[model samples]
Target: MDNNKLIEYLETFGALTSKDKLCLIDNVEFKAYKAGDVFLHTGKIANQVGFIIEGVFRYFFYDGQGNEITSYFMSENQFVTNITSFNEYTFSSGTIAAETDCLVLIIDRKGWELFAEQIENWNSIISKITSKTLLEKTNFQRRLINQDAKASYLSLLEQNPSIINRVPQTHIASFLGITKFSLSRIRNQIANK
Candidate 1:
């Protein structure tokens, strides 16, 4: 696992002892998905959590009117999982698909349980991860509730400029809770200014 990007990324959260590293090395698996692959589809039970070593993905769901509503987009060094389904062992409410050829480090439920049991200070790492996720969700919700489309789009540009280039315009529009036409107008407005 010397060249594994997942292990390298995990080290950012906390330093894993030699023993802890070995435990993770033994359990984590590497997987690759092609661009446009729907690795985890809606209504499926999400059993594995993964770290994006190289790729971009979006969490999307079909709204009642049969339109795709993208909730979030994630890129390299990020964790992408349907947390609600993974935690509850229920059907996933959305789909997670790669936007480009991607590599990920996956830890299954059993592997995660073993890692937690064997690794010291593992709970601290998990707690930090949980805290970050919560904060992001809270901020996103607050923005959606308080900010209009143009402000939300501008916020996205400020916070995640890379996403505008990696993801399609339509997906970005959906994530911003705006129409593609509206997104185009916003872009033109910004460009002219």
Candidate 2:
């Protein structure tokens, strides 16, 4: 498997020695998922985490009303996992599914544990990654809560310019907490402006 992208992303958190990087590479198995394939189903335990080398995944769950709600999108270079489920061996509250054909590097819980045990600074690296991921998700939620549909869509475009083209309109609408028709109208209004 090509590991250059993974290595580059890891470098952003901290300096990794050649041996450290090699160890990480050794523990991972590359996998492919078709669009719409679910990685972690809601209420299932997440036994693995994936690093996206290509494409997008959506984190979503069904509401009490049975409507699917998109909580977040994970794209290239991002790690995809239900953190709680993966860490605590509990059930995931949301499902993670591919939004497009995807390539990922997977490390199962066993491999992850082994990696952590072998790497001295692995915990510190994970801490930084976790902090950044939490901050981004929190910021996304904060922005959505304060914005109207149009404003939320605009903000999404500003943050993820290619998402509109890369992901399905229905998923995008769900993510913005708007009906698909409303999102269409918003897009039309923006185009006319």
Candidate 3:
């Protein structure tokens, strides 16, 4: 598995000693998911964390009406895991599915635990990664709360222009808290402008 992307992403949070990097590389497994394949299902424990090498994933949950509501998207270089569920050994409340065919490097709970004992800076590096992930998630949610659907969609485009091409319109609409019709209108309006 070419995990240079994974190593480079980790480097953004903090330095990884040679031993630390080697240990992480040894512990990870390379996995691929076809578009629409579930990475983590609701009601199942998230026993692994994935570092995306290619493609996108959507985090979603069912509403009271049994409609799937997309809450987040994770693309290349992002970590995909239900942080609380992974850390506390609890079932996930949402599902994570590949929005595009994806290649990822995975570290199971056992491998992660081994790193804590074997690697010197494992906890610090992981803490930084976790903090950064949570912060981004919170900020996105906050922005959604403050913005209308069109604004939210536009913001998403500004941040990740390729996402419009990568994810289905339905999923993007759900993520923006709008209907497919509304999204179409928004896109048309933007195009006209």
Candidate 4:
């Protein structure tokens, strides 16, 4: 991962001093994952948080029936982790899996704490990130409760067209809380219209 790109990405959140930027850079460790790899698993302690340097990952939950429900996708320049697990040092209830080959910048909880202690501006940045994640999750849950599968699929398509091509249709369907057959029919209907 290019350090310049990572610095540029961080700059978007807020302006940082040279010292602050260097401190941020010191905490990050780059990692790569192959397609079909599980970046995180449910019921495991999540020790690290990741910033996507490239590619995509799906965050999901599996039901007792072995059905998957995708919560969201994290792509280039996005941060992701099981928040509860990351913050509380508890087991995760959701899994994050690589949807494609990926490059990520990982910071362990200790690294994050060290950075937070040293960077005065980091608290505000962290708050903004958490707020946005919460808002997105809430909005998604609202949409799922109020809209049909077709509507949900359309929403996902509108927001992340790249995911339609990068992720499997079955996974997309699961994300939208619909059966594969239903999603196929919906896609066909939309295509014909």
Best by lDDT: 2
Instruction: Quote each prediction's TM-score.
Output: 0.91, 0.96, 0.95, 0.92
Error of 1 at 62 (Å): 1.5
Candidate 4, residue 117: the lDDT equals 91
How many pairs in model 1 have backbone atoms within 3 A of each other, for residues 3 or more apart or on separate chains, i.e. clashes? 0
Lowest-scoring 10 consecutive residues by lDDT in candidate 1?
Answer: 1-10
After superposition on all CA atoms, what RMSD does each candidate show versus the true structure? 1.8, 1.0, 1.2, 1.6
Candidate 4 Cα lDDT to native: 0.84
Residue-wise lDDT of candidate 3 within 56-120, one digit each (tens)? 99999999999999988999888899988999999999999999999999999999899889887
Query: Given candidate 2, what's the lDDT at residue 135?
Result: 97
lDDT of 1 by residue, 56-165 (tens): 89999998899999988888878888888987999998999998888888889999889888887787887787788779877976887799888998888887787788
lDDT by residue (11-84, candidate 4, tens digit) is 66777788887887888888999988998898998889888888899988988898778878888877868888
Best by TM-score: 2
lDDT of 2 by residue, 49-166 (tens): 8999999999999999999999899999899999999999899999999999999999899888987898777888888999999998899889999989999999999988867889
Where does model 3 exceed 4 Å of error? none
lDDT agreement of model 2 with the native: 0.91
The C-alpha local distance difference test score for the whole of candidate 1 amounts to 0.85
